[model samples]
Target: MDKKDRFTEVVKTNQGLIFKVATLYTNNLQDKEDLYQEIVFQLWKSFDSFNEQSKLSTWMYRVAMNTAIYNLKSGKKQVNTIPIDLETERFAEVLDKTEEEKIKVLYEKIQMLNLLEKGIILLYLEGKNHQEIASIIGITISNVGTKISRIKDKLKSQIKTT
Candidate 1:
Protein backbone atom coordinates (compact mmCIF):
# COMPACT_ATOMS: atom_id res chain seq x y z
CA MET A 1 0.00 0.00 0.00
CA ASP A 2 0.92 3.62 -0.47
CA LYS A 3 1.87 5.92 2.37
CA LYS A 4 -1.58 7.37 2.73
CA ASP A 5 -3.19 3.95 2.81
CA ARG A 6 -0.67 2.72 5.36
CA PHE A 7 -1.20 5.72 7.62
CA THR A 8 -4.95 5.40 7.37
CA GLU A 9 -4.83 1.78 8.35
CA VAL A 10 -2.56 2.48 11.29
CA VAL A 11 -4.84 5.22 12.65
CA LYS A 12 -7.96 3.16 12.15
CA THR A 13 -6.53 0.14 13.91
CA ASN A 14 -5.13 2.14 16.82
CA GLN A 15 -7.91 4.65 17.39
CA GLY A 16 -8.76 3.04 20.69
CA LEU A 17 -5.18 3.39 21.83
CA ILE A 18 -5.26 7.02 20.84
CA PHE A 19 -8.48 7.62 22.75
CA LYS A 20 -7.10 5.90 25.86
CA VAL A 21 -4.01 8.10 25.89
CA ALA A 22 -6.16 11.12 25.26
CA THR A 23 -8.42 10.18 28.13
CA LEU A 24 -5.49 9.81 30.46
CA TYR A 25 -4.46 13.39 29.79
CA THR A 26 -7.85 15.08 29.54
CA ASN A 27 -10.88 14.53 31.77
CA ASN A 28 -14.04 15.66 30.05
CA LEU A 29 -15.32 14.52 26.68
CA GLN A 30 -14.61 17.77 24.84
CA ASP A 31 -11.05 17.98 26.12
CA LYS A 32 -10.46 14.34 25.36
CA GLU A 33 -11.72 14.86 21.84
CA ASP A 34 -9.49 17.87 21.41
CA LEU A 35 -6.46 16.00 22.69
CA TYR A 36 -7.31 13.09 20.46
CA GLN A 37 -7.35 15.35 17.44
CA GLU A 38 -4.06 16.92 18.42
CA ILE A 39 -2.52 13.50 18.83
CA VAL A 40 -3.77 12.38 15.43
CA PHE A 41 -2.37 15.51 13.86
CA GLN A 42 1.02 14.92 15.44
CA LEU A 43 0.99 11.27 14.43
CA TRP A 44 0.26 12.12 10.83
CA LYS A 45 2.90 14.83 10.84
CA SER A 46 5.49 12.43 12.22
CA PHE A 47 4.46 9.44 10.17
CA ASP A 48 7.22 9.93 7.65
CA SER A 49 9.87 9.55 10.32
CA PHE A 50 8.36 6.51 11.99
CA ASN A 51 10.96 3.85 11.44
CA GLU A 52 9.68 0.29 11.46
CA GLN A 53 11.98 -0.80 14.26
CA SER A 54 9.17 -0.46 16.79
CA LYS A 55 5.68 -1.88 16.52
CA LEU A 56 3.21 0.61 15.07
CA SER A 57 1.18 0.66 18.26
CA THR A 58 4.32 1.44 20.24
CA TRP A 59 5.13 4.31 17.95
CA MET A 60 1.57 5.57 18.20
CA TYR A 61 1.68 5.35 21.97
CA ARG A 62 4.94 7.25 22.14
CA VAL A 63 3.64 9.97 19.86
CA ALA A 64 0.34 10.27 21.66
CA MET A 65 2.03 10.38 25.05
CA ASN A 66 4.57 12.99 24.06
CA THR A 67 1.79 15.13 22.70
CA ALA A 68 -0.12 14.74 25.93
CA ILE A 69 2.87 15.61 28.10
CA TYR A 70 3.63 18.61 25.98
CA ASN A 71 0.08 19.81 26.18
CA LEU A 72 0.02 19.34 29.93
CA LYS A 73 3.23 21.24 30.42
CA SER A 74 2.23 24.10 28.13
CA GLY A 75 -0.32 25.46 30.58
CA LYS A 76 -2.81 25.94 27.80
CA LYS A 77 -5.21 23.28 28.99
CA GLN A 78 -7.34 23.30 32.08
CA VAL A 79 -7.74 20.40 34.47
CA ASN A 80 -11.10 18.76 33.90
CA THR A 81 -13.01 16.03 35.66
CA ILE A 82 -13.12 12.54 34.17
CA PRO A 83 -16.58 11.17 33.53
CA ILE A 84 -15.96 7.46 33.15
CA ASP A 85 -19.15 6.74 35.04
CA LEU A 86 -21.30 8.69 32.61
CA GLU A 87 -21.81 5.83 30.21
CA THR A 88 -25.26 4.42 29.59
CA GLU A 89 -26.92 1.47 31.25
CA ARG A 90 -25.47 -1.10 28.84
CA PHE A 91 -22.06 -0.79 30.48
CA ALA A 92 -23.66 -0.63 33.91
CA GLU A 93 -25.65 -3.77 33.17
CA VAL A 94 -22.67 -5.70 31.87
CA LEU A 95 -20.40 -4.86 34.76
CA ASP A 96 -21.48 -5.50 38.31
CA LYS A 97 -22.02 -2.16 40.07
CA THR A 98 -19.25 -2.99 42.51
CA GLU A 99 -16.83 -3.67 39.69
CA GLU A 100 -17.82 -0.45 37.99
CA GLU A 101 -17.38 1.47 41.22
CA LYS A 102 -13.93 -0.02 41.65
CA ILE A 103 -12.95 1.00 38.14
CA LYS A 104 -14.23 4.50 38.73
CA VAL A 105 -12.28 4.74 41.94
CA LEU A 106 -9.20 3.36 40.18
CA TYR A 107 -9.45 6.00 37.50
CA GLU A 108 -9.90 8.66 40.14
CA LYS A 109 -6.68 7.51 41.74
CA ILE A 110 -4.95 7.38 38.41
CA GLN A 111 -5.93 11.00 37.87
CA MET A 112 -3.87 11.95 40.88
CA LEU A 113 -0.66 10.55 39.43
CA ASN A 114 2.00 12.72 37.88
CA LEU A 115 2.28 12.71 34.11
CA LEU A 116 5.09 10.19 33.84
CA GLU A 117 3.57 7.86 36.38
CA LYS A 118 0.26 8.08 34.60
CA GLY A 119 1.91 7.09 31.33
CA ILE A 120 3.76 4.24 32.96
CA ILE A 121 0.67 2.87 34.65
CA LEU A 122 -1.41 3.17 31.51
CA LEU A 123 1.19 1.22 29.55
CA TYR A 124 1.39 -1.41 32.25
CA LEU A 125 -2.39 -1.75 32.38
CA GLU A 126 -2.42 -2.15 28.62
CA GLY A 127 -0.19 -5.24 29.06
CA LYS A 128 2.98 -3.70 27.70
CA ASN A 129 6.06 -5.49 29.03
CA HIS A 130 8.76 -3.68 30.97
CA GLN A 131 11.13 -3.47 28.05
CA GLU A 132 8.41 -2.10 25.85
CA ILE A 133 7.40 0.49 28.43
CA ALA A 134 11.04 1.47 28.82
CA SER A 135 11.44 1.80 25.08
CA ILE A 136 8.32 3.86 24.70
CA ILE A 137 9.15 6.20 27.56
CA GLY A 138 12.87 6.43 26.70
CA ILE A 139 13.97 4.96 29.99
CA THR A 140 16.03 1.94 30.90
CA ILE A 141 14.26 -1.38 31.39
CA SER A 142 15.30 -1.42 35.03
CA ASN A 143 13.79 2.01 35.59
CA VAL A 144 10.52 0.80 34.15
CA GLY A 145 10.46 -2.03 36.69
CA THR A 146 11.32 0.30 39.54
CA LYS A 147 8.79 2.89 38.49
CA ILE A 148 6.04 0.35 38.07
CA SER A 149 6.68 -1.10 41.50
CA ARG A 150 6.60 2.32 43.12
CA ILE A 151 3.51 3.40 41.21
CA LYS A 152 1.69 0.22 42.17
CA ASP A 153 2.60 0.67 45.81
CA LYS A 154 1.49 4.27 45.69
CA LEU A 155 -1.79 3.29 44.08
CA LYS A 156 -2.41 0.59 46.65
CA SER A 157 -1.86 3.00 49.50
CA GLN A 158 -4.00 5.67 47.92
CA ILE A 159 -6.78 3.23 47.15
CA LYS A 160 -6.71 1.90 50.66
CA THR A 161 -6.97 5.36 52.12
CA THR A 162 -9.83 6.18 49.80
Candidate 2:
Protein backbone atom coordinates (compact mmCIF):
# COMPACT_ATOMS: atom_id res chain seq x y z
CA MET A 1 0.00 0.00 0.00
CA ASP A 2 1.00 3.62 -0.43
CA LYS A 3 2.11 5.83 2.43
CA LYS A 4 -1.21 7.67 2.46
CA ASP A 5 -3.16 4.45 2.71
CA ARG A 6 -0.95 3.14 5.48
CA PHE A 7 -1.15 6.41 7.42
CA THR A 8 -4.89 6.54 7.00
CA GLU A 9 -5.26 2.98 8.21
CA VAL A 10 -3.06 3.63 11.21
CA VAL A 11 -4.92 6.78 12.14
CA LYS A 12 -8.29 5.12 11.77
CA THR A 13 -7.23 2.18 13.90
CA ASN A 14 -5.77 4.42 16.58
CA GLN A 15 -8.41 7.12 16.55
CA GLY A 16 -9.48 6.21 20.05
CA LEU A 17 -5.97 6.73 21.33
CA ILE A 18 -5.84 10.13 19.69
CA PHE A 19 -9.25 11.06 21.05
CA LYS A 20 -8.27 10.16 24.58
CA VAL A 21 -5.13 12.25 24.39
CA ALA A 22 -7.07 15.16 22.95
CA THR A 23 -9.76 14.89 25.59
CA LEU A 24 -7.30 14.79 28.43
CA TYR A 25 -5.51 17.88 27.12
CA THR A 26 -8.42 20.11 26.20
CA ASN A 27 -11.17 21.85 28.13
CA ASN A 28 -14.08 21.95 25.69
CA LEU A 29 -15.24 20.60 22.38
CA GLN A 30 -13.58 23.27 20.28
CA ASP A 31 -10.26 22.83 22.01
CA LYS A 32 -10.53 19.08 21.84
CA GLU A 33 -11.16 19.23 18.13
CA ASP A 34 -8.27 21.59 17.63
CA LEU A 35 -5.86 19.42 19.54
CA TYR A 36 -7.12 16.33 17.80
CA GLN A 37 -6.46 17.86 14.43
CA GLU A 38 -3.04 19.06 15.41
CA ILE A 39 -2.13 15.62 16.71
CA VAL A 40 -3.18 14.02 13.46
CA PHE A 41 -1.20 16.56 11.54
CA GLN A 42 1.80 15.81 13.71
CA LEU A 43 1.40 12.08 13.34
CA TRP A 44 1.29 12.47 9.60
CA LYS A 45 4.30 14.71 9.68
CA SER A 46 6.24 12.15 11.68
CA PHE A 47 4.90 9.01 10.09
CA ASP A 48 7.96 8.51 7.97
CA SER A 49 10.24 8.57 11.00
CA PHE A 50 8.73 5.62 12.82
CA ASN A 51 11.76 3.33 12.92
CA GLU A 52 10.06 0.30 14.41
CA GLN A 53 12.22 0.59 17.52
CA SER A 54 9.05 0.50 19.61
CA LYS A 55 5.45 -0.56 19.30
CA LEU A 56 3.17 1.50 17.06
CA SER A 57 0.98 2.44 20.01
CA THR A 58 4.02 3.59 21.92
CA TRP A 59 5.11 5.78 19.05
CA MET A 60 1.61 7.16 18.72
CA TYR A 61 1.48 7.91 22.42
CA ARG A 62 4.85 9.63 22.31
CA VAL A 63 3.77 11.78 19.41
CA ALA A 64 0.28 12.52 20.68
CA MET A 65 1.48 13.23 24.21
CA ASN A 66 4.24 15.48 22.90
CA THR A 67 1.79 17.34 20.71
CA ALA A 68 -0.53 17.83 23.68
CA ILE A 69 2.32 19.02 25.85
CA TYR A 70 3.43 21.46 23.18
CA ASN A 71 -0.10 22.77 22.84
CA LEU A 72 -0.25 23.30 26.60
CA LYS A 73 3.02 25.22 26.65
CA SER A 74 2.38 27.38 23.62
CA GLY A 75 1.11 30.71 24.96
CA LYS A 76 -1.15 31.65 22.09
CA LYS A 77 -2.56 28.13 21.96
CA GLN A 78 -3.06 27.72 25.68
CA VAL A 79 -6.54 26.78 26.92
CA ASN A 80 -8.03 26.31 30.37
CA THR A 81 -8.31 22.69 31.51
CA ILE A 82 -10.93 23.03 34.22
CA PRO A 83 -13.48 20.24 33.86
CA ILE A 84 -16.80 21.62 32.72
CA ASP A 85 -19.89 19.56 31.96
CA LEU A 86 -18.12 16.40 32.95
CA GLU A 87 -21.52 14.71 33.15
CA THR A 88 -21.69 15.32 29.43
CA GLU A 89 -18.13 14.20 28.84
CA ARG A 90 -17.49 11.12 26.75
CA PHE A 91 -14.77 8.57 27.48
CA ALA A 92 -14.35 7.45 23.80
CA GLU A 93 -16.37 4.25 24.30
CA VAL A 94 -19.28 3.14 26.45
CA LEU A 95 -18.35 1.91 29.88
CA ASP A 96 -20.28 0.69 32.90
CA LYS A 97 -21.63 3.43 35.17
CA THR A 98 -19.27 2.47 38.00
CA GLU A 99 -16.25 2.22 35.71
CA GLU A 100 -17.21 5.48 34.07
CA GLU A 101 -17.55 7.20 37.40
CA LYS A 102 -14.12 6.08 38.48
CA ILE A 103 -12.67 7.20 35.14
CA LYS A 104 -14.43 10.54 35.41
CA VAL A 105 -13.00 11.19 38.84
CA LEU A 106 -9.56 10.18 37.69
CA TYR A 107 -9.88 12.44 34.66
CA GLU A 108 -11.04 15.35 36.77
CA LYS A 109 -8.00 14.97 38.95
CA ILE A 110 -5.69 14.54 35.97
CA GLN A 111 -7.07 17.72 34.44
CA MET A 112 -5.95 19.54 37.54
CA LEU A 113 -2.37 18.50 36.93
CA ASN A 114 0.21 20.08 34.65
CA LEU A 115 0.54 18.73 31.12
CA LEU A 116 3.68 16.72 31.86
CA GLU A 117 2.16 15.17 34.94
CA LYS A 118 -1.00 14.42 33.00
CA GLY A 119 1.04 12.60 30.37
CA ILE A 120 2.72 10.45 32.99
CA ILE A 121 -0.51 9.63 34.76
CA LEU A 122 -2.30 8.99 31.47
CA LEU A 123 0.41 6.54 30.46
CA TYR A 124 0.33 4.96 33.89
CA LEU A 125 -3.41 4.52 33.74
CA GLU A 126 -3.03 3.08 30.23
CA GLY A 127 -0.80 0.38 31.78
CA LYS A 128 2.52 1.71 30.57
CA ASN A 129 5.35 0.71 32.87
CA HIS A 130 7.83 3.09 34.49
CA GLN A 131 10.42 2.57 31.77
CA GLU A 132 7.94 3.23 28.99
CA ILE A 133 6.67 6.32 30.80
CA ALA A 134 10.22 7.57 31.28
CA SER A 135 11.12 6.91 27.67
CA ILE A 136 8.08 8.73 26.37
CA ILE A 137 8.62 11.69 28.70
CA GLY A 138 12.35 11.75 28.00
CA ILE A 139 13.20 11.27 31.66
CA THR A 140 15.06 8.75 33.78
CA ILE A 141 13.52 5.53 35.06
CA SER A 142 14.30 6.61 38.60
CA ASN A 143 12.73 9.97 37.86
CA VAL A 144 9.59 8.28 36.57
CA GLY A 145 9.35 6.31 39.81
CA THR A 146 9.89 9.45 41.87
CA LYS A 147 7.32 11.39 39.91
CA ILE A 148 4.86 8.53 40.11
CA SER A 149 5.19 8.52 43.87
CA ARG A 150 4.80 12.26 44.04
CA ILE A 151 1.84 12.20 41.69
CA LYS A 152 0.24 9.51 43.83
CA ASP A 153 0.74 11.62 46.94
CA LYS A 154 -0.77 14.62 45.25
CA LEU A 155 -3.69 12.58 43.97
CA LYS A 156 -4.30 11.19 47.45
CA SER A 157 -4.43 14.66 48.93
CA GLN A 158 -6.69 15.88 46.15
CA ILE A 159 -8.93 12.87 46.55
CA LYS A 160 -9.25 13.38 50.28
CA THR A 161 -10.02 17.07 50.02
CA THR A 162 -12.43 16.80 47.13
Please name the candidate that would achieve the greatest lDDT relative to the true structure: 2
TM-score of each: 0.82, 0.81
Model 2 C-alpha lDDT per residue in residues 3-53, reported as the tens digit of each score: 999999999999878888988988777777778888898999999999777
The local distance difference test score of each candidate is 0.83, 0.83
Judged by whole-model lDDT over C-alpha atoms, candidate 2 comes out at 0.83
State how far residue 36 of model 1 sits from its true place (Å). 0.5
Residue-level lDDT tens digits of model 1 in 1-162: 999999999998888798778877887766666677778889999999998986887889989999988876653555553433323355468898799898788788889999889988999999999988998888999999999889989988986887
Off by over 4 Å in 1: 73-99
* Colliding residue pairs in candidate 1: none
Q: For model 1, what is the error of residue 15's alpha carbon versus the real structure, in angstroms, after optimal superposition?
A: 0.8
Q: Candidate 2: TM-score? A: 0.81
The window of 10 residues in a row where model 1 has the poorest summed lDDT is 81-90
